[model samples]
Target: MPHDHPMTVDAMLKQEFWEALYQRDDRIWSGNVNVNLQTEVEGLKPGRALDLGCGEGGDAIWLARHGWTVDGADISTTALARAEAAGREAGVTVDWLHRDILSWRPEDAYDLVSAQYMHLPPALRRDVFTAAAAAIRPGGSLLVVGHSPKAMRQFDGQKPPEELFFEPEEITGYLGDAWQWLVETCETRGEGHHTDAVYRARRLEA
Candidate 1:
């Protein structure tokens, strides 16, 4: 099952490609919050949330339903439109922003900023993750999850690019002294040999 490639240059071309991908199907993802996300946030009190690369808005909707006001950001307009409709159907409201994560800058910090499975070029990913960590309010959390490098060997057919895969530390290392690590680990999923690197950290109170 091919997934949408990470954003590239040629802004218009990238948007059209992703839009077509989303329009080709009724849904692109499982339409449920990521297990890692669910596990990490299950105990935290709801607050202002930002779902980066929210695609189809699953995480955003989940956050909203759980009492957090959510802002879902994605590059594809079609995906955002579908997410908005899904939010309405789910009886929760999400502020959908049509923007690329690479260029997006939040006007305000969030209590929870999540970027799940957001695969981008190394430099761009580092920049975005750094900015995301910086956007967490004091005593808030930042969760970053992505495909582990081991997945390249585990799923030979997929052959994802090296730059797209990373270890939990690659993300967590971007955090400065302001953050406290809560969880940093990698685990394999059943059967497919799929692996995910998860990093959840809290911004220390200033």
Candidate 2:
């Protein structure tokens, strides 16, 4: 069955949207490193990593600090510049690319690919997942984290209403029948609008 709801906000392509969303507010996403990001990826050996929609480069810096070559991609040059500055300050090198995910392509495969809080419209979301899955090497992993549908009621923020946010089942459908489900859980975190749904899935080699 096809979901009829529009899944994406198209926030990446609009310069003004990014300017308003990112420009005067260059700071770490979530105001700190993603707790789940640290714990979930700690077990995997660091290698080439891609941070899709990397805002201010928090995760990218963290990954680079952990010994992975990080590519931080975002549509806002202002954001990318800020990320680069942070990377330099941290003494960690991260390749910052100002490219919209909808138009960007992987130059090569990666050991890890992550898209956090990038809630694309349904069709675009599927396209991105498929691309991200394909970009991972045989033994690599892919991670996506988004606002849970419940967040609409649990908190208040810019996140879309319940109708737009994702559910575990919806995410599973996006993964298709090909990827191996390593972890699928819906939980709340932070205060107010900070609560979100975190999901992690792995693509099998065989």
Candidate 3:
């Protein structure tokens, strides 16, 4: 899925790009947690969780409120600040880590690891997703939600190269079938073709 993009991967990976993105406005993402995430995780018993690319702390905060101890991490300092404030406002405490998830590996395993809409080139995405899978303790789950390639037309073709978009199979194939495929659905967001590819798999217990 690596192809030519108007912006190089290096540019997108830099903290400056994300910092500028978050600094552009008081908020970047909707403060609410992602619908796919909540729908898939709402029934699970709360445990330690990790939210990668956890912009604005919405998912992490939501998880904490639901009784999971959460560590929310992102590359942008500005985003982290906003997330911290939001977590405080929501009356939930989240341990926020500022680091580039592309290269950072979690030191502790989690009962669940979620990455929502963290689109990157397919190669880089595989590495990050692999690490996410590794960070899950046995019998835990990994949830990945992405902008399905089916919805690429909704992006106005301005940002996030098409190469970054993917279908559910691309993710399920990478880490192998060691996981039980729990959820594989392309949810329609609303009218007009907007959709999200949601994938959730539970790690097979040893």
Candidate 4:
């Protein structure tokens, strides 16, 4: 977030915080797909996918172009609108939903459920991750990517409290034994100051 932006815990939980963020900038994220998402998913079988906190739909759009049927969900109307426009421009259709993933309930209906950079208070984040995991069907995958706490802590006042960032175990622990780890670790985001903690797991087929 920009130093001008307030990132209080209370502010982050409210939809207005994100709406205001989008309102402040025409485009906050790089329109290209996130690096971890691409590295982990590029060759995986494309299927039904739910993009939790889809942001501007870069990942969703890319997935659609690669053959996945995707649903993009986010809390900000501003972001969703941009995502829809981008989808249209890209000539791919994605079901976009206006939703706060923190409280959103989803079924075990997607072959993949992805949550990228959706940071929150750890307790709330566990709820968010559990809910997202529920959306993945048996034999499906769950992919989560977030800023690594270890490196992000160097940001001083610019970043959210260290508590808001996470370690790989902190994320993978949100899953029950029904899931098997595919990848669980952190890699430099290449910014030299930032690292990405990633967790990719597959729901065991019963």
After superposition, which runs of candidate 3 have C-alpha atoms over 4 Å from their true positions? 1-8, 154-159, 176-193
lDDT of 4: 0.82
Q: Per-candidate TM vs. native? A: 0.86, 0.81, 0.88, 0.90
lDDT by residue for model 4 over 34-102, one digit each (tens)? 889989888679999999999999999999999999999999999999999999999999999999788
Error of 1 at 136 (Å): 0.7
Runs with alpha carbons beyond 4 Å of true place in candidate 2: 1-13, 26-31, 153-163, 176-194
28, model 3: CA deviation in Å? 1.4
Whole-model Cα lDDT per candidate? 0.80, 0.71, 0.81, 0.82
Error of 1 at 198 (Å): 0.6
Cα lDDT tens digits, model 2, 1-206, are: 01222223543346556655665444535535677788668988888999998878888999999999999998878788888888898999999988878767687899898888776667777787778877888677777777765556431223353454665445656655553644434455554556666666766666
Lowest-scoring 10 consecutive residues by lDDT in candidate 2? 1-10
Clashing pairs in 4: none
Sorted on lDDT, highest at the top, how do the candidates line up?
4, 3, 1, 2
lDDT of 1 by residue, 81-162 (tens): 9899999999999999998778777878999999998877788888888889878888788888888777665231455467
In model 3, what is the error at residue 46, expressed in angstroms?
0.7
Best by TM-score: 4
User: Which segments of candidate 1 are over 4 A away from where they belong?
Assistant: 1-13, 153-158, 178-192
